[model samples]
Target: MLRSVLAVALLCWGADGAVTCRNENDEPVNWYILYKAPHLTSQALTGLEYVYIDSNVMRKMAPSTDNYKDIKHPNGVLANTLRPLLTPIRSMPNNFGFISYSDQPPGCNAMDTFGHSKGVVMVDNSGPGVWLLHSTPQFPFRRDQNHFWPESGARNAQIFICVTLGYSQFSHIGMHLQYIGAFPFEHDIPLDFHQELRDAVNWVKSPPPNNLRKLISTDVNQPFYSIAKQQSEQPKVGDLYVTIAQLLDSDLQVQTWGCQRDRKPSYCVSGIHKVLNIKDIHTVLGNWQPKHDHSKWCVAENPNNHWTCIADVNRATTQYQRRGGALCFQNQRIKRIFLQVAQGTDDCSTLNIMDTIDCEPDPHTPSLMG
Candidate 1:
């Protein structure tokens, strides 16, 4: 019943044609997650494959594709990077705002200190649009220029997750940016004039909030949290986490369980099956077809527990010093993908490992320290 309702909503929403995400082929997608595999994959074309997943059920884990349909301009994300900007003011929902920020914002230098989070936020005045988060640096290109991926960023595997949501939920997102101290870049899109938007923008410039927060992105069915290093309470929500090593926050005194944020093992996650990419690196991505790729994600080994998440930072070193975060959910299809592709860890030499009955530590993570 719920699935049917969501399907109907998606159809109506897609038909509106107010916004469309350009995929690898420059084809419009209701939403899509593209994983630009790094060179470590086991296949020949091996390191490169794009995973396209959208709101439409038929497109679920469609196929492994590297061939792009557009080159004259950036497709996937770069092409439709400024959908909100294109909206006719008269056609905008009662309230609509698409806000974008980057340390390396177009027409400006990258802000040295800012949230490590990178993505697009487009919500109707009443609240309906997708938040596109990705690991690509110097991307989304310039709003006016043709979108193109930087050669520097192309070598590493990158991931993108586009989740669409209704309006009310953005208030929580506003609160998150407040906690992360994410400021609106010089090129930032003006947020809604409403109080909630004001609060988010103000929080970017003000002092810290009282404590940590756990909020859910209802549209995507994923829950996200932020733990400020300055706060007294420790990072603890008790769920498995995942991200890449380069983006880890290393400035803090991060605890080591068994799964280390970086490869050092000095920062370990004691018992849980800290998913690794050490083995065959080949798994069923879609149609259960064998595909090799470099995408960071997590899944509870216990199937019934069903905790699957796709993220950017690895629990590696120096991440504590930087602001970082990840969001997870209990969805069945998302769970299967992460779980099937999960790689188990091998014994490490650098970090000290103490055996304990418990492996899964209370959910604690170091995130954007605004």
Candidate 2:
């Protein structure tokens, strides 16, 4: 399938004067943005964080992006999928960041015959990985960046989902699956945005399903945890040069994409391709996935940022799958872990395993010395 798509991409080459570009099956294509710089920055990080925690921001930019018409409602689907995730973040009082897209509304005119002839889309080498946002408003794509978001007492925190796309000829699917990074962002206390960002990126870039899941599940047994925990515990948000220097030492690379390769600034016809550290930036930009959810961790440095914590958490989740399962999980090296909790019945009351509650005494000293 990818071979066929590549053939089409070859034909669509801007040099060929193909006018309009399409997949092998000839479906109208949309430009997809897979990675953004700094991996975690003020605009990409704080902007989305503010929107997610604030209802006003959520209303204006929850799924912020330019809406296109030709694609029949791409924005709607994309925005809806992300709305739930952003709402909580926007509601936070201190969060901040911005939202934007590479493609304009009604999809872009690949023929280079309409508004912004510079608009274009690109798919990953794999095959429909995931769909984060569409280029159009009906289903626009947006980003969040909160490098210093504070969480005094919070649960059910936000998780980041990074995806890669591949085009298909049979279904005329213009995107394929390459990689998925599912990273949960939480702090031990006194939140450190930079550290969480580093952990999230490294977790996504780590290697596969087990590694990625282990990052979010807080599974101690996972191989990447030692490094992730260590870095996450370190300092973030300090002197710019100092932070950048520290990031480079860890293996993050800074790259620029979405421009011309001909020694000129040209719009990326196949989207953008660059690398950077996973920690430096806030937003998790990239292509969206469709049906499959494949997540894992690999030891690769992202040229889009400057730090090296590339863990992924893509397990192809259906709307149904996300709703089920225990909310809190931890990874343990032990093969089996047993716990004692209360079970539930008619009215609901207890700390049994079935009940899903804990009756253990609070470890902290009495608040009022009771």
Candidate 3:
């Protein structure tokens, strides 16, 4: 039944109509998540290999053969979904619009003041679009460049969450991006579209004075919550994970760039909610420490809450002074996948880990400060 619906939707779109997130097989999907593994062993991994999960996988509640693919492959999920924007065309339709933003843009120096966000938002005037939130820097290069992925992105682990939303949701997304201080390297929002998108593009030039912004998006069948925080001069109110843990009213297990200098220790001071840092991850490829992973995400500790978020910032002290955000949702399967990978945490004594296996340090990997 799911295949039939997707096939019908594909037929309706007719290959070149509305922009949507495509699955591994290039089929249109409502949403998808990809976890690109880092180059753990020089002999086996390329760091471009990733595990994929989409609306179909969620429906089945089971892993599939197509769950794993190469990010550099032309027929892979990343290439399949981004072909419309990256490939050159004689003339673009009037209804199509897009925005590519990143703090570390290709052919440019990384911006410290802008949001640490990176993603592409593509929408059609007819009322459907896709929002791709990711952790890879300098990715999906400017449309004019005709390059989809960057070589530098393959060196570290990354996470990407893409959702297909209706046109009405773009305004809310725009507002969230504005709050995060997103730096749009390339964009084209038609005048006929919502005014907030134009404002988002303009916000990059003249940022607002707001420290944080939050919004709930229900334009689609599912509900998505977004939270954005700007670079604060003081650490008075800039711990993104802590704020999210409090907002959801649940303890969290977070993963981020652990090798960064001045990395903050796991937060257990909040009596109501504790944010523990994930130190080791167990994926299909193999087990690895946080030193080899650069993905940023968090999952609710309690199974009942079922909250999962893919974020753009790290748990490092320097990151607190930078703009960033996260897109969150409540999903049982998604939450489970994130939870299972958390084999060990900074405060392992607080949680039960009798069944967890510690990953041995790789001899080939260079030592880095954590």
Candidate 4:
């Protein structure tokens, strides 16, 4: 049964014509440049917040990518050029409030300290959360090499996300990076991407406490900790525990879409299907509402089943006069990149990138390139 109870709005949600949110017009909220959540009206729905940095600023600090132009592999293979491109990273560049380390393999590995898989370097700075950096043999044919971020310099194409537990800035709930898939490498970014990142960051920083209480606010009053524990304990593949150390990879595209809303807020869980040591509740998006019916969404686990929550993906949407990476493509033509933290949902439609791109698997092609 759907329960109607008082709750917070942790995600930037939109109603038919309006939305209630915090920081609607605050100057601090103006710090970001992507999308903006409508100012929240209820104090209970104010735990959402987030931020996106310029990855290009960080790219500039790294040795010039052009230096690898003359670089060649031992076998004189064109792919060998990928090595020189990475050689500049022998020492990680410092930019922003983050300190990065480029351990590019073969040396004392500090990145593997977190029980990560072999060959995979961990990107952990004195920031929000630890990220997995896997340099596939696809580019540079090397192992044991990893890069750490430094504090200082510009935030080029890579933006790091810092998630918090409450209003307190001291507590870090989680952290992730929203790598600008197109910008610095190509030199342009969509205005909407910047706006979306800006808006997302704001929501993440000041999340609605209701998101936390929603799952735990029941007859049993079970907290998120318990729910997560229950999900983790259900059953998992041993290989998945080691996937974080494996090369970065993705599954093939499947087409589907739909929308749904429940009187009670719902959640969407993300996980690895084994063979990789990377696993966790990536994000918990909240307070979703869609114009279409819930029947438009589909689930990865159950194709016939409907989906209510939308995974934070590489969106190719655009907003006129907006400035940022997401807006580069006027019609939303970005690759499926990083995942956004999940939020609670009232209604939502699950749209897949393949459906729009016609299931063409190619990261090299950038339609909304920067």
Top candidate (lDDT): 3
Model 3, CA-based lDDT: 0.71
lDDT tens readout by residue for model 4, 1-370: 1111111221111121111110212111101111111112331212112122212121111211222121122311111111112233323222101112221222222221111111111111222111112211121223212322111101111121211111111122111111111111101111232233322233222211211111111112211110000011122211111111111222212111111111111222355321211111121212222211010111122222111111111111211111111011000011112112121222223222122233222233112211
The local distance difference test score of model 1 is 0.43
Model 2 agreement with the true structure over 121-234: per-residue lDDT tens digits: 222222322223211111122222221111210111122222222322201111101011222122111132223233432332222111112121111222211111111111
Q: Give per-residue lDDT, candidate 4, residue 52.
A: 23
Global lDDT of each candidate = 0.43, 0.20, 0.71, 0.18
Sorting all predicted structures by lDDT, with the top scorer first, yields 3, 1, 2, 4
Worst 10 residues of 3 by lDDT: 361-370
User: Among all windows of ten consecutive residues in candidate 1, which has the lowest summed lDDT?
Assistant: 246-255
Clashes of each: 47, 117, 0, 106
Model 2 / residue 181 / CA error / Å = 11
TM-score of 1: 0.62
Question: How does each model score on TM-score?
Answer: 0.62, 0.18, 0.83, 0.19
Candidate 2 accuracy as TM-score: 0.18
Please list the residue runs of candidate 2 whose C-alpha ends up more than 4 Å from where it truly belongs after superposition: 1-77, 80-126, 131-163, 166-229, 236-245, 248-370
Model 4 spans with C-alpha error above 4 angstroms: 1-95, 101-113, 117-237, 241-370
Residue lDDT tens for model 1, 1-370: 6544543443333334444454544345445566555433344333334555554443255546444432224333445534454433333343446666443444444343554455566665443555666655455554443434444344344567765555666676666555444545522233544455566545353333434355544434455443332221111221113221211321111111223323233224544234333332333332111112223454454545555445433343333434434444456676565444444333334333322222223212111211
User: What lDDT score is found at residue 170 in candidate 2?
Assistant: 9
